[model samples]
Target: MLSYNSLSLYLQVVINLTLLTGLILLVRNGIKTMEVIMLFLSGEFALELTDLVDRLLKLNTLNTYNYALSQFLGLVMLTEIYSRYFLKVPAFVKWIIYGYAMIFLVINIMDIYHRAPVTFYSNIISSIIICSFAAAYCVKILQKGKVEKSLFIVNTFVFLFFLLNA
Candidate 1:
């Protein structure tokens, strides 16, 4: 029987592999959003691999920092993707997103500087922001009355992923 840590490591490896495969496929297809998505996936894949190595090396401090960085980048990348998904993203809304990301980054940096444990509040906030983006995308699709199967599928998964995380 696998220990809990071993099982978790295996799962992480599997997820990393899946993300890599998706990145490759997205690149080959030359989708309009390919660059943003590929960047997101690549960054996440690198961070996750770093996390795995940190864990194996028993570097708890580095793992915590990695997690914080991953959450911050994920927030930015997902926001960018959602902003581009809409034909008309409001200027004020974009400013709000930018402000929120800045605040989050500041909080993380402060925590790291003080050698404080990172807080879950940032994760919760990030999840809420992403879920809202997903909801807006859904509303946009409804208003357009034309569903692109691929987008719908991606939107559904994103919403579910964030919802569960929240």
Candidate 2:
């Protein structure tokens, strides 16, 4: 009788863990940093871990840790991939990362105080935004057949949960 979101979150974590293990292996294998492999692996690991914490604690069903992590981690992985594949951006991207982290920090404080359903639901909304941007970037890369090695594992993690109900 669990909600679909919870069900998906659980499956996503499992897939993400699997992807993270693969990323760790790739990191050990070579290819250095920011390879297609590295970006994907890092994203998968950070994202999945964030979701796992939310699940384990049963906090903020909508505005969960996973939700917050999705935005932050998306920025991290995208930066890695873009920096590797495209132009080197301004150093401000680091501050951008910090910005997202700060927002998450606030959300955590709110979690302790309010524990509102809105907090958990906010995760769903943020995740949707993250997913949309990711999908667009993924499509651009997929078209070129030039995805980061890590992306394949990340894709597996994302897809596995979305289809788990089947």
Q: Number of the top candidate by TM-score? A: 1
* Model 1 alpha-carbon drift over 4 Å, by segment: 1-18, 113-118
Model 1, position 114, has a per-residue lDDT of 58
* Range of the 10 consecutive residues with the lowest summed lDDT in candidate 1: 112-121
CA-lDDT, candidates in order: 0.74, 0.57
Q: Report the C-alpha lDDT of model 1 over 106-152, residue by residue, as the tens digit.
A: 78766775544445677787888888888888888889899876567
Give candidate 2 regions above 4 Å deviation. 1-16, 35-101, 142-166
Weakest lDDT window of 10 consecutive positions for candidate 2: 157-166
Roughly what TM-score does model 2 have, to 2 decimal places?
A: 0.49
Candidate number achieving the greatest lDDT relative to the actual structure: 1
User: What's model 2's overall lDDT?
Assistant: 0.57
Q: Candidate 1: lDDT over CA atoms?
A: 0.74
TM-score against truth, every candidate: 0.76, 0.49
